[model samples]
Target: MGATVVQLTESKKQIQHTHRTFDDQTKAFRSNPMPSISERRENLKRLKRLILTNQERLIEAIDRDFSCRSKDETLIAEVMPSIQCINYTLKHLDGWMKPSKRHVSMLFQPASNQVHYQPKGVVGIIVPWNYPLYLAVGPLVASLSAGNRSMIKMSEYTPHTSALFKEIIEGSFPGDLVSVITGEADVAADFSAQPFDHLLFTGSTSVGRLVMKAAAENLTPVTLELGGKSPAIVSPDVPMEDAAQRIAFGKAFNAGQTCVAPDYVLCPSDRVQAFVDEFRTRFSEMYPSIRDNDDYTAIINERQYARLQSYLDDARAKGAKIIEINPARENLGDGTRKIPLTLILNTTPDMKVMQDEIFGPLLPVVGYTNLDEAVHYINERPRPLALYFFGYDRGQQQYVVHQTHSGGMCINDALMHVAQDDLPFGGIGDSGMGHYHGKEGFLTFSHHRAIFTKQKFNSGQFVYPPHGTSLHKMIYKLFIR
Candidate 1:
């Protein structure tokens, strides 16, 4: 089968029509999708139940899609994040939905001002393969919580999970309320062109640009979660053993395939060897055996595996030292599909791996003069999706946090910043646009309608008759001043 999932056919036309039903009912939905804050909260409750009840199937499908994803990992990382996000919304949705109180000028003292949250109408969600279930459904929950009907375009890289999700959602939701579109490549291009009120996409930077351009045709707002080379700077103040364990755990989990995983590390030049020694010990403790091991998941497909291998070979050719972190005697054959746990040292900026986001089990260790050099080197690159620092000093942590803008950050840890539902999750500059999760997600999928109520007495009647010198003087003195 082609990378595209849906083709032009009778079946595809039916699916397309079904997915377009939300746009069809735009007028009715815009009027009453959720008239009150309580209703939006109830919708969140329903979606949370759906996720908790079906988590087993989600786990199974993810495993089938990616050779050996850990059930616990999926639940902890993806499922729990979504659940926590729902609870966060449920806890705060009412207050968010409540109109904000604005001060009225003395001239219009009788009137009131506030902003109301309105559904963005039809929402389009495009997901990627790495964590198909979570990435797909997480945005869907936000759309639904905002009281918008949705259509989801699953990643072509993860066919099995997409098919399963299609069955479940189609079986549960009315086409007009919620739908799934499983289509071939052109269909995604076509879907992107449709008139959606808003769109949210989670994928690589190149595809994110394409999705944005397509949405631009309709002036549809979009929340794009794009990727970049995220960096981790280890302050020499941190304890070696603790820092190594945390960094090792993040880089190797899911084969270092996470979007926000630290792409490389910077430490003092003299401390590089000590850091490596501690990381080596941590890897053994984390995963004693990884070959054909159910605990370690493979790259989504052979094409990606080859891409990763190409990066490794390119770095090796460029005079970078490659460190093998694999257990003794492992198979790289079809059954296991295992590549050795790999690390790189003595790397330079020109190396191919350094230039790109290494979304694989390859970690690079580079030396720097100190925190200043590390921060400067990262600043020179595209702002990252995430930044990691391993230190306990409050001033250093605050300095890095305030000085650099990332989608998010983790102090003394790696990648777990995403799990905290209270904080916003997203990127900056080339990393991508907009944010979601908790209140951010609700706000992303909503349109805050600015409303100003006027009392029986017209507040602006004095200036309305026409533009006069006296009125201009009153407006200038009362309003401008």
Candidate 2:
């Protein structure tokens, strides 16, 4: 999604305008022993049970906020991932918390070294509205697993879901270790300003920068999972039909509002039409009248709907073709705004769609003369949160993986990279910074301290004498070297 850009611009004032507040309760609830590893495991179990018991509430709240979030989507993207993370972390949390051993140097005989992974005190996680519960709880599943207290700040756009999450988390954990803060963007700025030991934010690149800047005041390490113009490169070798379906599936999921959603397609000049045709057919067969349908989710609000509309309007006014791929559609109003599923024959770098992250159901198909052009296009832009390559050629896939950088990548598919717990989920460069999930998340909130134990050995005592002897010079070279 683009970002609560306007909200951030007015964060200082809008925060005051909200009338909602989160400070009066901070100090009262801030006194608690930061959970130890064992305490954290037990607390995590409690949180898991709480989520399991309240799944319905989470789903219903998200559906209400989205206007129409698919139950299956909630289960797969939100509930299932969180459940999986909890399970994965629980199974390995103990091992993850153990201090690591290191070898001692012979030069300093009898000295031992160890790296202790300690939690970085309190953590701050800022969640976006698109997937409120998931964003709110997902990072906590990791931070808590790492034995750190966390404060979750949720989006104002999804007020219903944010409130429900606050209630859910409050019931499961003490407010000190796990407090949910909900208000406007100002709350986010204010919360970010707090002296958190660590901060994890999932949102737009613009806000990610501001979050990073605010956190810099405290020099708090930040994990910013932000968005950018992610490109799905269609290699020359992959089957057009298969690649199109997978890409379409990824783009269609969440109505293309996902952060890692393939923002645009980079294909060979000849195969561009074939890719678009198949994608159009696949999308229509999967969901029809999506704008008014209960299955397809509406844009979060009027402002976002207008933003997507503006992108299309700006591009079309600049002489670009816009096509609604789906045949079934209806009147859109009263929290309904349908957008073109596909835009074809548009390759200009200056077009509005080409220039921005199309978070809605907007896809721009850019034709590259060759593979180099496609790679060049991607490399020229800021490193994306995700990169999807559709190709069977191992060399080309490997080349793209090594040559260009992204938070993550999907081979022969799209948006599935984030699904893998083994792979680190995060961004590079301006897409955002830091990584999370599983070990990455644990390491993100941990301060690994290196310890060295030196023993008092009589063998080296001769080097410590005041006399300027030859042995002292030899020992100085030997020891200093």
Candidate 3:
């Protein structure tokens, strides 16, 4: 009973701290609402320096959190992208900050109209566990670039990395400008309920709904980066080796914990076996050994491992053929949390693996007889975060692009669309809501305030209060037509 009381007290204290931090950030934003471009640039530079200086430490922390995360994967997927985003933002901040000149109708001649992008005050960022560092840094880059003070809520599943992130951010930034919140689920709920200017969440779809609900209470605008079952379609004419190799790379990277990872493959019905064989070969070549291999990344935790294992069991019981691509055939059962790249063939819509977002190293291969079948299959479900089509035919590509819906797409490739710094990344329906990568990111965090200036002459006065006046009638007759 005493311990329970102590825990309750601590929870209350953390909640209080979260509220205080948010209020502080709000106050700070009001004091210096729109920071100068130089200030924003300096903030980005400081962030880049912090990441570079502590790159090894951050990598080690994530490794500890995952038990066996690949250092190379961390560098390529997380650190590199974070730094690249900062560089991209710094290079284009000036152009994005310039007020956009807008056209005015002839009736309003002698007046100048433009759109000024103003910061949206304080922003709230909720980071998920799969790619904690990059997800946090990506949104932070956008928020800072738009000159908004932000508070980040790091996932509790990644304790080591989260704690280190909070510490490092505290050292580099003032508490009122940028703060990192770390706690349990209750704390996250409280954080979500805060009255933020804008909230950006990166996580699963189920949790995203709850976050949106909490944000709605405050009428806070949100940019949800939720994950769904992103699919990859292979054309009949495309070489099996090319399609398989690229799809295998996308699935095996970070052990398929990526939000944009290819969840399933929609292959030509006649070439299923050939594509499967090539995928197995390519995956084996990428990592010859799963157990005790530094190149192979393990699942984040035991809970996630069990979840994936259950998915395989359920799929197997539902008459799906399971293929495990373990080149060394080593025993990975000693709580290593390492799962080899597994493929599920003969999947049905009823199976859990097919119904849910397979955010692990499990890929399901679904057969399609024609292009219409493939397009219909995808359209029947909620729009995915990404869709990959493996074909070189320009007409076929155009047809697919026009007929299908996804947050993003890569023709003749997989998972590379997100690495491009110029493209806007987001989803449509169930996958997610708003874009936040390049210029879109800056705009998402800014309010496009329209401004109209007229020198000495008032054009709107002619149409003012008194109705049917000679001037008003003349203006109406001249313009309303």
lDDT of 2: 0.80
lDDT of 3 by residue, 184-293 (tens): 88889999999999999999999999999999999999999999999999987998889999999999998999999999999998999999889989998999999999
Global lDDT of model 1 = 0.82
RMSD of each: 2.5, 4.4, 1.3
Which pairs clash in the backbone of model 2?
none
Instruction: Identify the runs in model 1 with alpha carbons over 4 angstroms from their true place.
Output: 1-15, 22-39, 333-335, 464-475, 478-480
> Model 1: per-residue lDDT, tens digit, 1-481?
4523434574478456744565665755766766466666666777778778888988888888887788888887778887878887777777777778888778776799888788888888888888887787678877877778788888777778888888877776767777777756666777777788898988889888998999999899989898998988888788888888999988888888899998898888888999989988898787777875677777888888888889989999999899887764565655555666688998978888998898998989989887888888988889999999998999989888877878889998898988877788898888999998877888899898888898688767776755767877877797785
Candidate 1 clashing pairs, residues 3+ apart or interchain: 5-184, 6-183, 6-184, 407-426
Best of the two (2, 3) by lDDT? 3
Best by TM-score: 3
Give the winner by lDDT.
Answer: 3
Q: How far off is model 1, as Cα RMSD?
A: 2.5
TM-score of 1: 0.93
Ranking by lDDT: 3, 1, 2
**Model 3 — TM-score against the truth?**
0.98
Query: Could you tell me how far off, in angstroms, the CA of residue 371 lies in candidate 1 after the best superposition?
Result: 1.5
Clashing pairs in 3: none
